[model samples]
Target: MAEEKDAAEALVTDLQKKITDAFDVFDHESNKTVDVREIGTIIRSLGCCPTEGELHEMLAEMEEEEPTGYIRFDKFLPTMTKVLLERRYRPISDDIILRAFEVLDENKKGYLTRDELVKYMTEEGEPFTQEEMEEMISAAVDPDKNIVPYKDYAAMMVIDD
Candidate 1:
């Protein structure tokens, strides 16, 4: 158990050093941090391709101590660790589907009624046709409960990429 604990600590320390070194290359201004706008560059430097929306979502996940939208090495470490882990384990579409479910499940009931799903699919941005909406609900909705749990929704939308 002690050996396992020591190994984990060593791994974390090594990752932190690599991350801080990457940040240093871009922290040339001596601010000891990277602005949120440079997030894409930093992510790419770290060998990840993240959309602008994803970058904003990451910043949103940071704690209150990360004010000014500037990310220091300490703040960047945990956030990037989470982001990398999620990307490695989760399908990209899962995040999109989860966000959509959150928007439609306004009551925070953890499930969406058929009507809520329809409303979401028909909304202004990229409106889904009636047929597509019906297909989506039919594929994911629970017949007994008349709702789609977020897990079911994500499963229906996930593409093995």
Candidate 2:
């Protein structure tokens, strides 16, 4: 009861500290504010993945608060807390990620060669852009085998909270 409340409050404090520290790095001039234009990077640095449209929407709220177009720490903190609590950007479950890879593996090979994944990611369904494919492959492929061992990759991809 009381302990749970204290734990939740402590978590919020930690999140606020992290966001403030990241915001300071980009603040460069120590203005205690950041350009609204860089809000996406700020959010990403804090491990939040809001889409472009979502960023636009969030920035709209900041626009109302700071007519000067820079976001202060006070304005940034509550907005970030709301976004985190909503959990809209939570990582996809590992089970679902593994299932997706299994579908691509086709022959139950338990892995995807680099070339095969490139083709599937770039040509199938809502395709990955060239940059997205390159990034995923670089991080996910086995250098020796030249393949993506997706079972292991899923563990890397799913960042729990």
Candidate 3:
């Protein structure tokens, strides 16, 4: 039990690091706060295409307040990793992935469109090629694509016990 607890804590720490790294990549100015656009860019980088609406939905999950429309660096980054890993690592369940998708989809829409993906990328100041955005959307939402909806996008993700 003690070992398991240690492992879990370690996983969380590693996940924090990943979030930090990802933020570094997305936060061009390095001031910390990630605006809606930055969030969109990061999603695109992760190989997922989100519609503008969907990008808003994902940001909603991390929003600490309203109007300001910003995700504080400390809260948003850590929570994203925690929520993402919890969903991915549960081998016995798709509940986590399903729920996350639901959240990102916002409007409870079943799928995200290319326009949304472009919106997110543009906001981040890092735009994706049409081909790249399409490929990412396919990975995340296309029933035919299987890159996501896995235990983790990759094994490098930190998992909780």
Candidate 4:
């Protein structure tokens, strides 16, 4: 138990060190801080590819206490750690998702209409609950196309190793 705790602490320390190193590359002046705007780059340097909205949300959380113009190592480390760990949770791969979607696309159109997706999502297999269907549709559907472009949707969900 102690060993596990030690290992977790060690990993956190390692992450902190990496975060500091990445921040330093942009810090330039040895202030142990960087402009709040640089937070996205610093997090990406540590290999967390957060979406722009996600970055904005994180920045909002940081400013919850009060607006800040710069981020210190201490503040950045925890946020970066959380982002890294979250990124570690792998998304469903494109190939697997493509195969699954292919099964849904009997007409070979490379897409699924909203109605088809709704039917399959709500009535087929284990089925997605109403909320799940809504969320999936919001993420997977193309507003203009009014269809789930399965290939593009699958690609969007794939995360590089």
Candidate 5:
């Protein structure tokens, strides 16, 4: 237990340093924070192509904690940690995928219907086009059930393939 706790703390420190360095590159104003517009580029630099709505969502989430329109390095730590983790660990586990599905499954439904996915993806930040949503659903949804199960969603994101 001690070893595990130590490792976790070390990992958090490493992530914090990495995030600070990444944000520092864009902190030209020396204010230790980046404007909302620069967030997309910073995230992209870290290798995540977040959609416009996703960026907005991230900002809104950050705002909830700090109530500031700008993104301070400390406040953006969680977003940076997620991006770093996703990059370092590709082909996330089924459990992680299921958790993500749960976020979109507002009604606590075990499976995601086409309309539910469409609404979740379109109603929020950047609206996904019909074609894009269909493609995403078709790729993951089971043909027989016409719904996306946790397993199928995990399969769609398998990095090994």
Candidate 6:
């Protein structure tokens, strides 16, 4: 008889693994804690570049203690896992996807302009160069040169892959 793993336990395990991997990749010297600057680089390595202020704020929230500025293995693990689990559990219904598209297409023209992308992603301080935004929209737009539909957006998030 195998015992079922509780949600908290599972989340803790997953978060710890991710934190360990991040530490290994970012900490070339294998120091337990990465310097504040390196934390920004690590977050960028995960694809979204965080501004300095954003990095500081995020780290401040993540760190429970002040001394070493460390996200202790125990403390870091559970938080990350909870976030991932919530994301995984979120029901991306068709209505939700349609609403997201509508939100993104602020002009209601059914297509996302480069300006809109910049404006949207900028809330996170992730400024995309005009060229980058253009490329992203090019890839995201559907055939017939029409804007990406809700179905397409939802398909991008398929968890079972």
Kindly give the number of clashing pairs for every candidate: 0, 0, 5, 0, 1, 0
Off by over 4 Å in 6: 5-15, 37-58, 64-75, 78-95, 103-109, 119-154, 157-161
Better model by TM-score: candidate 4 vs candidate 6: 4
Best by lDDT: 2
lDDT of 2 by residue, 1-161 (tens): 99999999998888878878888887967978888767878887777766667778888876654378688777888888877766555557889999999998889999999999898887877666677788899999999999999999988987665
Query: What is the overall TM-score of model 5 with all chains considered together?
Result: 0.47
After superposition, which runs of candidate 4 have C-alpha atoms over 4 Å from their true positions? 64-66, 86-161
Better of 1 and 5 by TM-score: 5
Clash number for candidate 2: 0
* Residue-wise C-alpha lDDT for candidate 4, range 1-161, written one tens digit per residue: 99999998898888778877898998977987788888877776666655657777877766537666887776777877877656642346689999999998999999999999999977876666687689899998899989998888888866575
lDDT of model 1 at position 21: 77
State how far residue 48 of model 1 sits from its true place (Å): 2.4
Candidate 2, residue 80: lDDT: 87
lDDT of 3 by residue, 1-161 (tens): 99999998898788777677777776666788766567766655443444666566767777766647566777676657755565531332355545544565566555545555456645655576777667666655435542244333323232333
List RMSD in Å for every model shown: 11.3, 3.4, 11.0, 9.0, 8.9, 6.2
TM-scores vs. true structure, each candidate? 0.46, 0.72, 0.48, 0.52, 0.47, 0.47
The 0-to-1 C-alpha lDDT of every candidate, in the order given, reads: 0.71, 0.82, 0.59, 0.79, 0.73, 0.57
Per-residue lDDT of candidate 1, residues 1-161 (tens digit): 99999997887776667667788888868777777667666766665655546656776765355378676666777887766545532446677878877876778899988777777778756676677677787898898998888766686666553
Instruction: Kindly report which residue pairs in candidate 3 clash with one another.
Output: 37-123, 37-124, 50-117, 51-116, 52-116
Per-residue lDDT for 128 in model 3? 66
Model 2: lDDT equals 0.82
Q: How many Å off is the CA of 12 in candidate 5? A: 1.0
Q: What's the lDDT for candidate 3? A: 0.59
Best by TM-score: 2
Show the lowest summed lDDT stretch of 10 residues, model 2.
83-92
